[model samples]
Target: MTDASDRLASVRAGLDRACRDAGRAETPLLVAISKTFDADAIRPLIAAGQRHFGENRVQEAQGKWPELLAETPEITLHLVGQLQSNKAADAVALFDVIHSVDRPSLVAALAKAQAAVGKRPVCYLQVNIGDEAQKGGCALADLPALLDQARTAGLNIVGLMCVPPADVEPAPYFALLAEHAKRLGLAGLSMGMSSDYETAALLGSTVVRVGSALFGSRA
Candidate 1:
């Protein structure tokens, strides 16, 4: 087996074990983050039966995925990075799920774009769980308002997402995100990454954006 295929199997096995250990009934969507690697590197995972993939940018995904997706139609694409209002149309047209809806203006742009393109991609509102200045999520205090805005603007909000402070124990943040989603009547929790996905699955993460753990270190 190729390296990507082997890693893919390992990640899948890990996910299965995590779900079993946590008594999670349904399998969380494992989004293979294919941000920098080209299609050549990604196809092995696809061939290994990885149907869900993630890309960090619309331009990069555009450069690589169109041809690949044409060849195989079942792949689900996720936009897992910060999206600009200007790129809303392109993002809505390309991705199946967007994991970075952070603010009201972005919500408005995405609503308009989805309407124009006639694609209602599932959205996850990013919460700045750690309140980092360099991050791109809405503040925790503002999430309710942002969610209301998204609903009023007619966006299909699937869940909440967050990047906990780096180098810290992410369990608390994951728990908090799950709790918030539950309180708001949301079902999905798009948290976790290569590092803490098992813990996230245990904490009710419906989507796990795994990258290096499955694809190896980026160049």
Candidate 2:
């Protein structure tokens, strides 16, 4: 089998095991992040039944996904990167899910964009779980406020998304996000990556964004 299929199979099997261990009857949605990789690189994964894909940039995804969407209209596209408030309209036009609603301005922008475009991509409030200064997520202290603002603005806030401090063990951060989700009664936790999906799954991630592992090292 081709490399992408082989890797996808591996991740699926691993996710299955993780769900079993966690006593969860359902596996989190596996969103293969196809940000920098082009169609040629992504086609194999699609051929192998990867229906959900994630991209971080508006222009980059705009440059590519239209034709792919035309080819496979059933595919679900996720915007899993930092979304600029101004690009809300562009993102709403293209993606099916937006995983970075972190601030009031973005919340307002997304609400307006959805009303104008007549398309409402599912939303997630990104929490700066690590409280890292350079990260794109809102500070942990601001999560509830952002959630309220996002919901009031009419963005369909489905759950919370986070990127923990790089190189840390990650479990604690994942658990923290889970705690927030549970407390808020939100059902989605968009966490984990190629390296830590198993742990995230075990801790109740309703969706996981995976890259590199399926597409191979971009480097």
- All candidates: TM-score: 0.97, 0.98
Give the distance in Å from residue 52's predicted Cα in candidate 1 to where it truly belongs.
0.7
Model 1 lDDT per residue over 98-162, tens place: 99999888999999998899999999999999889999999988988999999999899989999
What is the lDDT, from 0 to 100, of the residue 26 in candidate 2?
96
lDDT of 2 by residue, 21-84 (tens): 9999999999999988998888899999999999989999999999898898999999988999
| Regions of candidate 1 where Cα sits further than 4 Å from its true position | none
Runs off by more than 4 Å, candidate 2: none
lDDT of 1 at 93: 95
lDDT (C-alpha, whole model) for all candidates? 0.91, 0.92
Quote the lDDT for 73 in model 1.
91
Model 2 clashes, total count: 0
Weakest lDDT window of 10 consecutive positions for candidate 2: 139-148
